[model samples]
Target: MLAHNQDSLKRTPLYSLHVSLGGKMVPFAGYDMPVQYPAGVLKEHLHARAAAGLFDVSHMGQIALRPKSGKLADAARALERLVPQDIVAIAEGRQRYAQFTNADGGILDDLMVANFGDHLFLVVNAACKDADEAHLRANLSGECIIEQLADRALIALQGPKAEAVLGKLCAEAPAMKFMDAGPHEIAGIKCFVSRSGYTGEDGFEISVPAGDAERLARMLLDNPDVLPIGLGARDSLRLEAGLCLYGHDIDTATTPVEAALEWSVQKSRRSGGARAGGFPGAETILAHFDGGASRRRVGLRAEGRAPVREGALLFADSAGGEPIGKVTSGGFGPSLSAPVAMGYVPTNLSALGTKLFAEVRGQRLAVQVAAMPFVKNTYKR
Candidate 1:
């Protein structure tokens, strides 16, 4: 996360509420965000997995794309020009994950694209929001209306009990399947809700007017099954879920294929498909789809209790030879009660059960390549 001076840091709508709840504030993405609460990161992580965790993600960017030609397909097609995803195929009231790619096949930023009938809604990383808006305006202003929803506050209600807690306020919560997104009324507040979140649990992300954010958050916290979560636990949860953090797990230098995100690129955007090779870096990215990338992102399991953090160099063996790869994200997974991490390694060494060594504190710690999502996902399909 990007850090800025405390004086220049922005505050989310829930800042006061977080302070009232005794949250430990820290600079994140140029905003003063809570890193943890009184209950601490460990408890918060486990609570979310067992119950529900409400997260203040107002820092994320929300944008709306309306077609000038009065057709949603026009907007989708225009978006397809920038991202490799099949936006045109996204059904109404459904959303899909996508990435903005550079001409050299590097990812500019990752985002969510939701089809809302006449328009498309996008949620992008907070640190990349400004640049992402500029990118859209530069490439899609003519074919679509690019409006940033700066007045909205995004709240994520994640975990297994998310539905039970949110259903008390919105009846439609029970009917919404994973990735289903649309407008809904919660506690008499008009909001846009999506059954998706960073955690590998069934949940909902609600976008509400900034003014009513505190009230909505307070109401959600009123439920016994829900607890307020902060950024610390959020990171560990996503890491355990095998999800990528924008700058750490992915960035401008990482291609989707190299990051093991080829699944986000739909078949329509692949070679010989209907809309193939129109996006930026289509040649390079698509080539990787056919020939494969030199390295692939894979999960890593440390043999001991010590966590191998980001930037830790990976070696082929404990004896110390040439560095084979590097750890990108790592921490103690609360769900697993052990250290889990994700890193990039040569395809030959990325297979499950492949043994590797990570240099931590000048000591070569044994690590094994493992399958991702160390914790099983409980999405309600």
Candidate 2:
């Protein structure tokens, strides 16, 4: 988690609610965010896996891209110029995961793009939001309206019981499959609801007016099945799900293919496809699509109970040697009850069962390349 000046830290609309719930406040992405509640991180992580967890993600940036020509395709086409995804083909009321790539084929930031019939809605990472907004404006202002939704507060209800929990308030929730997104009235409040989440569980991310955020959050929290979760559990959950955390697992120095996210790049955007290339780094990114990158991101399981934390140097053998790679994200996965980590290793050493060593606490610990998502995903598809 990124830190900021304590004096200048911002607060979300649900700050008061979090305090009342006994949340431990911490600095993250320039906001005074809750890292855990009274139940603590371990319990919070397990609760979400078994039931439901409510999270205040209002710190994320939300922007609406409206085409000047009053045509949704125009907005999508303009957005395609910034990302490698085939945005023009995204159906109305649906969402897709994408990334902003630099000319060097490295990721600028990852985001969610949802088509809202007349406009495209974007949700970007909090730490990169400001730069992302400027990038969108400088590139797409000529063809679309880049309006930031400062008045909106985002919340996520995630777990196996997410659909049932949200469906009680909005009848449309149950009908939404994975990646489905659109507007709906929940508890008499107008909101943009997406059947998606950072946790690899069935869930919904609701964007509501800031003024009505606390009220709506209270209504959902009133459900016995829903617990208020914080950043601590959020990180562990996403890690167990094998998802990348921006600024960590994937950064300006890591390409999408190197991060094992090539699945997000649709075929239509690949070479020889209908709308091939055109995005930043198209040449380099498309080239990697045919020929793989030198290093690849892979999951690792520590040999013992000790957790190999981030920044730990990795080597090809247990004996001391020059570092081959480094752990980007590592911790004890609450769901797996074992240490799980992700890092970049040479393409040749990324195969499952390949043994390696991680330097932790002045000792080289044995680690093995393992299949990702240590715990299977239960996404409602």
Candidate 3:
């Protein structure tokens, strides 16, 4: 979805509103996106932790995989063939996170899959949408129909007060548990909402009609607790939550085992289970469950306030030993009031409390392996 030569960058439904609110826009995933608002990234990060923050994620691709018949399992089964996830076991009104892996057990893209009444809904990264759609068309049987809901827009309302704020507009929003999704009529607009998001907070991601999106967003902003947030805070929030940002934290060269995403591939997808080995790269991925990966991702905490930026090489000691790994995502965690980061290191050096040094600004900065979610995940499950 990159805007190559002769193609201009795309704009989201909320572009004008972002500009009106003093948002600083930047190009991201082929779209003109807001990096921060008038309040800045620091305040926006803290606001999402203490109150509710609304984010426009309409650039993401919303897809519907509908089987010819009403049996949802048929659609789920077809999807299971491509991903190493127990999609068949996903109950109605529930959602799960999954990745599309290439033949070598490398991630093609990470996406969110939700089970609606009679179909499966997938929210894929904007940059990989076209390729992902092509992959689906090539792999899924004809009986499974793939449709991209281009007329819809995705909005994320997150934080502790998110439920209460959204509840006032949609009565059922507050009652939903984490990863729950269902039909709802919000402020007179028919939409599908899921009690999920990337901020590691109790929140919801609402898929509303493109035409009604701006109205709904404005209405949500009317709430005292909701502030219009942008991509800057979104990245910092997810980074502090220990969540991976597709291209940075996980890419084509990284495997699930090495990325610390083993739990995503449930036991049913592994060897000795009822259904196993159907997904792409199953041999290599499943084998990793037993033999373990040579390098594993780990959470890191810098000793001081200076944030360790991505691509910083890691060393074993002050003597500048051979580089052990590289920082993938790193930033100042507002909630934690410290510099937090994640990186891949050798298995022996990835254990909690293990010491490592990041080459920051030509100096080796001391860092320690620490538990992730620099700020505890407050998901209301």
Candidate 4:
């Protein structure tokens, strides 16, 4: 359904390359993205796990924030008013995965908040870019300059062999640890490289000027250890790793606590009480933590071949008739060779092995709320 408008959508910086390589273009987040190459989703997914896979993620929003006062800590503190993370303490060259939460404490968007010392670099969902930037501008106090990097290109190299591939281009890449980022020169081109990714594997996300993106992509593709992956495979990969997709598994209606993301709130931010907490929905979020939430995000597995998809009704085995929850993300995993999903169920039925039912196509499929990462994550810590 999301691909219905693919024909008229704009393409990314590597559009020509994707077309040249036989990409199956589809509409995703308002942009025409390659859902898979001629190799298809299954092979692309497998390639990324066994070797390195490159991704074109230029459609996502990139912004640089610099406070008029030129103080990075002050800017971070200002940002803290709208999000739950302890931004003040994030070291330079370090990256933190966080969220932009609404006044009700429900996530507006999940984002990567990176401290670039002199400025802050933010990467947010492409579909939510306008709203996210507007929200930041409305909330940030005083003089802060926000520069959108709409002309930049993003590429992710992920898999067990990722380091080997990147190391050959940037000798220092292999030495980078998880969540760490720095400026680097790769193949004579200056770029930003971070040791992180969404696929639950060892990886690096490279940000480069839009003009040089195609060249860099070609270079990476030429490596025997690397292949170009697409959005379809990216979806399956992140799902298998138990990561949440912004608009689906998480949204403005779901609180962080209910979303199983309490770790994003640091200990000090809680101990210091109300004044210490400045983000939207602080009261609701803190209350949920103290008393626990009514429902929680969990993994679900169907008993048979049919794939349970988003919006499928979830029923408790004990309480038969009415729906107790809904699936947010579900599909057949290429690697696991089975169906897997992430959803929210009432707290009482949110444990491993908790029997449930997914009503798909008028048939009640046997389902169970299972532990996440239906496949174990191989992230290099």
What does candidate 2's lDDT look like per residue over 1-381, in tens digits? 233367689999999999999999998998999999999999999999999999999999999999999999999999999899989888999999999999998999999999999999999999999999999999999999999999999999999999999999999999999999999999899999999999999999999999999999999999999999999999999999999999999999888999999999999999989999999999989888998899999999999999999999999988967999999999999988999999999999999999999999999999999998888888788
CA-lDDT, candidates in order: 0.95, 0.95, 0.91, 0.87
Give per-model CA RMSD.
1.7, 1.8, 1.9, 2.2
TM-score of each: 0.98, 0.98, 0.97, 0.96
lDDT of 1 by residue, 66-117 (tens): 9999999999999999999999999999999999999999999999999989
**What count of clashes does model 3 give?**
0
What are the per-model numbers of colliding residue pairs? 0, 0, 0, 0
Residue 63 of model 2 has an lDDT of 97
Clashing pairs in 2: none
Instruction: Flag regions of model 4 displaced more than 4 Å.
Output: 1-8, 271-275, 318-320
lDDT (0-100) at residue 374 of candidate 1?
92
Q: Given candidate 2, what's the lDDT at residue 297?
A: 98
What is the Å distance of residue 306 in model 1 from its true position?
0.7
Displacement of the residue 37 alpha carbon in candidate 3, Å: 0.8
Q: Compared with the true structure, what per-residue lDDT tens digits does model 3 show for residues 258-302?
A: 999998988888899889879888888988888988899899999
Which model, 1 or 4, shows the larger lDDT?
1
- Give the residue spans of candidate 3 off by over 4 A: 1-7
Off by over 4 Å in 2: 1-4
